[model samples]
Target: MTLWLCQLVTSLQSCLQNKIYDGKTLTCTQTFENPMCLTFSHHCFLPSWLFVKFDVSFIVHLWHVFLNVHIKQALNFSDTYVVHVNVFVSLQVIKVYNEDNTSRAVEVPTDITARDICQLFVLKNHCIDDHSWTLFEHLTHLSIERIIEDHESVMEVLSGWAMDTDSRLYFRKNYAKYEFFNKPLDFFPDHMVSISSETNGMMNHSQLIQTFLNSSTCPEIHGHLHAKEQGRKSWKKFYFVLRRSGLYFSNKGTSKEPRHLQFIAEFSDGDVYTLLSARKMHGAPTDYGFCVKSTKRGSPRDLKLLCADDEQTRTCWVTAMRLFKYGMQLYQNFIQPHQKQKTPMRSISENSLVAMDFSGHKSRVIENPSEALSVAVEEGLSWRVASHSLFLYVSFRLVPNEHHHGCPVCFAALHMAQPWFHSKLSRDEAHRLITQQGLIDGVFLLRDSQSNPNTFVLSLCHTQRIKHFQILPVDEEGELFYSLDDGHTRFADLIQLVEFYQLNRGVLPCKLKHHCARITL
Candidate 1:
């Protein structure tokens, strides 16, 4: 190969020295003595005119071709061998907005799923992977939004949007995305469920989801819903029935006869979306509004608008529709995170930690199970007491005058720094924030009481509805403290109160699992 390349270089140099040039162009058809020239005739040509047009770059390119041929022949390679590889990658740039309307541009593959994108952002933002992160498709023109399922291909979802439409993808936490899997009874109320009247309307709670997943069995959800008239502002209440085929309404008052049923919409060609402003924008009778939006249409006039009496009823209908549409795929998405979690290996730090009893002069490991449990309980209590004492001391130092009308100054200094505390926020605003974040069981935020200036309120979501509990300022032994259970449970400040409720349910419906966060990214 080296000798052949050297001979080729010598031939090129000779061709360059003996080149004939006309006024119009330079031309040289130099022939070589090498026998391999006949084998690679196309690449072995000595064209001096190429140097005039493309310069040395063209000559270098031909030299590489000759070298490749030489190597191929020496190694007994096939004639159809390729020297260079061309790779084509399918990548797309997408912008995902947050609840605050701030967006971050992400470069993803065309086949990327919504769950994969959520995992990417979760890793990029250094967030905990609690499996509640969700992606939303928001249509600004229609004032409608829907939760993009975890298994859905994001590129496919983007392909359905009109080029001129004001549509966006949002990344946020939606704890209720899979809450139906945990609490099926709450989602499918007894009155709303109609399982074909078989077995005399007696179905086990455990078997409720099985009915939806089984193709042989048909589970129908029947209820009364207020539907908006097309191209009109008035809404009329009707008895609606949801099935695997499509949504239907009874034209003759709750009758399930085929003659009385009128088809409304189908799930295969559209999706369910929660309306942004039910009353103000769409003239909904109540705020608990949802709609079936056709994938082909981007206008509000095409929407099959629906309104429910309350949040739970709306949630039930929406969850049932999702189940009817996706079937077992939704269940698989709910358990996918759990399936990915491998059995945790014992860590070195955990192995080093031992339950020890230090009450005696010499500390020893508690080998007995009962002894270890007792020790753990005692240590927990001691730690709680120590922390409480430290908090009280700090509060006293911050506010020396304990009798100064509710300790507003000290309370402001401590709780204002916490992310969960939203001081002076109104009741409506608190409800909006909690609803915007998620309507999961434990999502909550702390805000000042709207009616009383001195007191604060804990706005929390239990079962798809936001409930408030006032944190009254209690005067115990001439010292100021905050309590949710009248005066039974007292804390030095609001920070301690929130932390306690996070661990212990206390008077709240559920433990505070997540706080309503308004992050910039």
Candidate 2:
């Protein structure tokens, strides 16, 4: 059956050649060694004849050429290119030593910080510091020493940067949640539902507090304070209340927000639990020093918890963030793309991944092959094709959109001359033209010959349709040229400019509406 099928197809090359655009039947004509057919049918029916009479070899060659063209279209030079985006920034905020505070943005790794971002804030009167105190102040919680010295009792408690003798023994006996009223914080989502009225329909804050407090031997409060203040303030108010109720209240204060309040509480509990257990046996005041202690089970390891339930404990922790060594390696790694996973290195890389190369016109295929997958990446580039005849080179450098900026295309065009295909406009000339005309760089208004404003089609060389063309300057140099769109300036810039003016003159007036100079990536 397969042999007959091959033979049948082999005789159809002649019919296929004559039926290149035929929308009728499955035209099978073999003109060369290649046995193929171009089928166009509305119904499920084979051709009337089983085979065609043509040079099968010639047909095969044509098929190969066609296949190659399709494959090239699929993976050759890019109609869409990659933009080299880079997000190198930093943040500048005034440092008030009043209290140790941990902010989400501050806690993030340094590479995620961009100099430009920092500068922006700095320009707006924010303090920008690039010193060791700033970096270390944010990364000390993950220290190995602290982790080793904690002695928590439950699974949740044990994991709180300490060793847990009771938890270790309890795990050996009972590992169920309900069996011990203990649950891991990791078990819950970052965002959780809450039903407590005191928390304004938020989760039970007191339960979270108790859980962390019980895990450690002592209660701690942490946060920042002015330079005049001292370290670690005891919650005298809560202490008296607990004392009157015959309960021990060790609250530590911290500058970390409510989210970290839990972690600090739990960590403090583990250490405090161990120390209190030991001190109780030794009949000591428990407040002898700021360190860890052992447990009743006689674990040789010294375990201590800093209770940061109050502002003081929180302050200490915040201070710790500042003390932490700037993890340059980890910070850089996180900010950059994971090369092994083929993820972008930086936000800029992901953003600038889309681009084009129109230096010449040989129908260049889309550049970035990965772009075929429709992912929510950054809008990398915007191409503005010239409509008439002038060809001008425009370049721009843009910050994020949140910075309140607009497009730079029209501003670059105002001073550019026409018949641009052969103009000799220089970068200085173009700059002078726009600056002298006092044209704002980014706004545009496209129009047609009827003297009415409208969008024009800018097409590629081989394109027969009048489609709006998009052009992005491929040159990286922060310079470009412009000339008259008419035949007078025939410079390179003039060629593109002329083409643009002849086709869409209406785009001129409103060019200054919200224009900004183009930012070259």
Candidate 3:
């Protein structure tokens, strides 16, 4: 039967190629090999006499109909037959720029999310998935940019963009995207947060985010912000309240009354963006300027420009707006990476290892957490001392003239090799690099102090603001050391200082977690 169908198909193909058909009964006497026709033996059956009066086009149509019907039937018998389907997926071309302005064009599915794009780049660039990588939408004309939420559709965002605009997508680290989940207090100061009138104005610091997520309760973020008046260049200070419904400003002095509360904007129709040069571009009073950009309008005139007194204030407002808009979805984005981690970060053998004390000739595992921590610290200090002694010995052997100079010169050169250390970088440049990388707590870099050539500065980000700590050179016992606290706590080199701060917060606001890095792709 299969051989006969193969011959029939061959005859039809010959007729189609010649553009000729006769109104005569067809017979399958000519032998031909067709691998495809044999698979339809059990799935389909056709009477040979049906093709007696048919033309070439009718035969082709009938063949397709039978093939489709047989294919549908074969799908039910999964063990015996397999069907292949060709599905066309819509694709979009998007260009993502790095910190150095180098761009890479990527072809992704139209429905790809921002998180998926970040993950793609992470794999391509061979970067660690620290959850700090973020996608930013930069509008060149307005000089404003905003972090695209992880779940936001990239195609949807592009749909809102005008073709003539010079808007771009940036792939970079933005640690602050989910920093609020870790440091809720820093993101939401107690003074800025308040409960609705139904309950006492007091709010639990631990449950502050819970209040925002709970639709039943109304959590308000109230503060005084400088707002740029509509169609005017001048700005005025107004008491603003941000709730789940929308943002409102009090016409009267800090009044929460319904009559005095005038609506400013809502997050449902707008997105919050940070101004690149607030003072220069928008004549903003301060550099900490953020605006509510309407999704429907791309012009700067449609923006609801607002400036906070400080970075913390601006972060509080922006973070609150995100929570109000996305609610639990933002939280899910924060924890989704962790949920995908199938294996434990630490192996079972590593987890079983504990700190052991051997000072008493007999060794015993330290049960107390504090005792274990102290033992670990002591071991770390001893190892550093041994390593330092070895470094001095090696220097003495390698370069005889440097024996008297000690390890200061060698230590200074050590930081030059570190990725976080950008020598001779100005304070402003350091701030820019850290800001471009991530304006989250503990994102830091080291640079030479412009004012004092002998010292270095540690530029760190905390509460969405950049801060510089001067590391002055301290001389003690003919050995040069670096210290942030005048000669109290000293380190042999800037590397040691940075490593110490990474483990211990000490005088800094937060422990260093991420270093600002630039990669050429």
TM-scores of the candidates are 0.76, 0.15, 0.72
Error of 1 at 20 (Å): 49
Query: Per-residue lDDT for 1-521 in model 3, tens only?
Result: 44445667766444334422121221112124642222322211222222322332455565554444444553344443333322222456789998879998876666678888887788667778888888999999899999999999888898999888899998888877887877788888888888877767666665788887778988889999999999999999999999888999999999999999999999898999998999999999999999999999878789999999888898899889999998999989998988869664565678898878899989998899998998889999999899887755443232235554443344326778787888878887888888777677789988888998668999998877788999997766555678998888998777889999999999899999899876555
For model 2, how does the per-residue alpha-carbon lDDT over 243-328 read when each residue is reduced to its tens digit?
10111222344222333222212221223221222133332233221222322322332322233232223223322221121212
Better of 1 and 2 by TM-score: 1
Better of 1 and 3 by TM-score: 1
Tell how far residue 104 is off in model 2, in angstroms: 27
Candidate 1 vs 3: which has more lDDT:
1
Cα shift from native, residue 100, model 1 (Å): 1.7
Per-residue lDDT of model 1, residues 1-521, tens digit only: 34445555776555434421231123223236542332322223343222222224445665555445444554465655443311122457889999768998866657778888888787668777889889999988877889999999889899989898989999888878888777788788888987866657788766888888877778888999999998899999999999989999999999999999999999998999998889998999998899998888757788999999998899889998998889899999999789868765565778998888889999898889998998888889999899767756666533456576434344335787787888878898888888877777899999878898778999999987899998998876656788999899998888889889999998888999898765555
lDDT of 1: 0.78
Q: Which pairs clash in the backbone of model 1?
A: none
Pick by lDDT: 2 or 3, better one: 3
Off by over 4 Å in 1: 1-87, 197-200, 345-387, 398-408, 411-414, 417-419, 502-506, 509-514
Which predicted model would earn the best lDDT? 1
